[model samples]
Target: MRHDHHGRTHRLELDDQTLREWDCTVVASDPEDGLVLDRSAFYPGGGGQPPDQGVLIWGGVQTRIVGVRPRDDLWLVPDPDDPLPPAGTVVRGAVDDDRRSLLMRTHSGLHVLCGVMARDFGVPVTGGNMEPGVARLDFDLAEVPAGFKDDLTAALNTEVTADRAIQVRVLPRAEAYALGPIVKTATDLLPPDLEDIRLVDVVGLDLQADGGTHVASTKQIGRIEVAKVENKGRGFRRIRLRIAD
Candidate 1:
């Protein structure tokens, strides 16, 4: 399978994040295992980002896809009450635009935060998680500087206003590692057997190995608010962020 494939399904979202709706054929369907499509734009969750939610329409019938399971094939879990499309059925799949778009902004915003923290504070990210418009990233900071939250919030929005272009690329493992410290996270969590690395670059700001969707530029992230800062443990500072119009 290709880098853009999950089993038999060709993952369209990996190459085109803006794709919301696409026509595909049903390769397999099971009441419990869910539906598998020959081509899909639904993003199967990974790298701390959740899977996409959407619907499959065929023959005037609709199957609400509530979640995606990355099994041997990309399984789209449908609403239990909705009728399942049988195998060989041709359907139009649509990802929830509001949810996916917001998530893209939120994910890009986090990368900005990571870049700022690394450049200004000299700390690496410890962990993180995100939803549509809200997220939290943990940092390996031994001490919180005075006025850290306010300073960080101001710096983040400044970068967003800078309107830096966000670029994504796939590089061979050795070539990517040669760039040095591409994993801005505290730990090297990438699988050893992985032969290729997907990288997200915030133009002149940050470049790191990532596998989540993102907006085209920083300005698309809108405004960023530092909602809260917490100390989970020694050297663990968690910063929560909220994205607003």
Candidate 2:
């Protein structure tokens, strides 16, 4: 499958993260599985980010999309009480801008955290999770330096002030792997059969193979606070972050 496609649905978010509204036709619809559109900007949940919430409008009616699932094809889950647009029905889809925009900032903030950790402490991301304005990333570090939280918060905001450009690109799997050392992490989780990898590059800081949406620049992520750091057994240190304007 192409990087811009999830089964039969054209993933517009992958190409245009700023695209909030678009028109498309429903390819299929089921009460349980939800609707499938030929073209969609709804970002199905992945890589620590949740799916988008939005609505589909057609013929003076609205179907509120509460979630999205990617199976054999992308499935748009609508509110149970709302009506589902039938197959072949043309509709205008609009992603909730506030939610998606905050998510982009929060996701990009996580990348800044990753970049700072790799550049300053030489740590690798073992795991992570995020919501609209809060996120946490687990690192393979056995010890936390004294004053780590405050220092990290300062470092994070410093990079955000630098306003580094965030660029997205799709590359052949082999080529994406070539930048692994620069990324300071291994792409071992990727399937062997996958031919292309989508990359998010925080210019002059970090680069990694990723499929999540992100802000166009670091400054757009605004201020970041290191909320907390938790120890979860032998070599796992989880750092929590809170994003703000």
Candidate 3:
């Protein structure tokens, strides 16, 4: 029985607070950084955006975030060099505000790109990464026109200017599966519990089973432009974008 704070709640204010429900409490430390928080608003870095970084403080000890990787069902934070306190130790967990914010906005922008592409030209995502300033996504299409890049750039900018909302929710896996099958390229990341699923919806644009943290609105993403589109292979094309004002 696990869940994330999304559809059930509104007005995610941890945004203004520099913390996403960080509190001091006793938790049994697991080898895997998959923190079993009584509750966590911090998404475990999936669908891009990378893992989160934060400090876990206990008594006089401070354990910096080494790697916040998600392993299927659990998000693991491993202390390879220094061993964390014994299980059941009360500690404070803090998320890296700057990193988290950037990741959030970048991730949302990726969705916006997908939505617009799907709506206008029928492009679906093959892969993507929500890096700090630049994001990249692989699209499956052939024979891009010379003006294709400019056209897409302008269209995506229009989307960010519109500032649509981005939504994240955990739904029953069976229910999510009922929505549709995972794109072949994304099948590997599919949740084990077809009955329990995570859904990331770009309000009126795009929606899919995702477990990633994103901004509340596209406005938070500012503006975007296609930096470059590389020819990966026969039918795969890579698009690099820059987030701007």
Candidate 4:
């Protein structure tokens, strides 16, 4: 199945892009190092995180994908400096699994933090990004007491112990809005339409309309630590955090 929009070609699969290496047929090829696969899970990164970089293999040739750019309903990337594959060639595209897994973990971890902050402290997330071992989120707040930070950290670690299932699903736009106030502040990257919306729900904890890879369970995120909280504006604060083991 293919749903092409916003330079997103294969996101309809909704599987972790880096971990699973699905063999595919190259429906089309470009000598300028451009190629298109019948299927892919590569995250042409968004939500502030940079795009993933890795390799694509076609029989005896392996080409690096250094940059990812989106145009129309397709994502474009260079096929590294290597022999070209003619149209109708079969190839296997893979992303850096280690980096992608870390990103998935960190991205889901942020949701926990965001949820905890929203319920306990009434601090909603403004924006955020996740790296392997480091991540930061922006929240609207006047001032955050240190005690609250420690409590927040403790709360997040506690949730990891429960090991909640990280559920992902797509809902119609009206159904999404029916999620009520919890999703009020979360961002929806989906195109505005009468179509269904993709949502990541932390099973009984938090839910948000999103379009990124995530861990199957909260346990994979382990413990999350709120490392630092900086005052970005008069009433805006940014919290930096990370997930471990």
lDDT per residue (tens digit) for residues 166-241 in model 4: 8877667788778865352545445665477667888877887777778888898878888987888887888888
Q: Give the 10-residue window scoring lowest on summed lDDT in candidate 3.
A: 6-15
**Worst window of 10 by summed lDDT in candidate 2:** 180-189
* TM-score per candidate: 0.98, 0.97, 0.79, 0.87
Clashing pairs for model 2 are: none
Cα-lDDT of candidate 2: 0.92
The Cα RMSD in angstroms, rounded to one decimal, for candidate 2 relative to the true structure is: 1.3
Q: After the best TM-score superposition of candidate 2, give how far the Cα of residue 205 lies from its true spot, in angstroms.
A: 0.7
- Number of the top-ranking candidate, with lDDT as the measure: 1
lDDT of 1 by residue, 1-245 (tens): 46788899999998999999999999999998999999999989988899999999899989999999999899999999999999999999999999999999999999999999989988999889999999999999999989988999999999999999999999999999998789988789999988888899999889999888999999999999999999999999999999978
Task: Give the per-residue Cα lDDT of candidate 1 at 206.
Answer: 93
Candidate 3 ranges beyond 4 A from true positions: 4-21, 24-26, 30-42, 69-83, 173-192
TM-score for candidate 4: 0.87
Best by TM-score: 1
On the 0 to 100 scale, the lDDT of residue 35 in model 3 is 45
List of clashing residue pairs for candidate 1: none
lDDT rank order: 1, 2, 4, 3
Best of the two (2, 4) by TM-score: 2
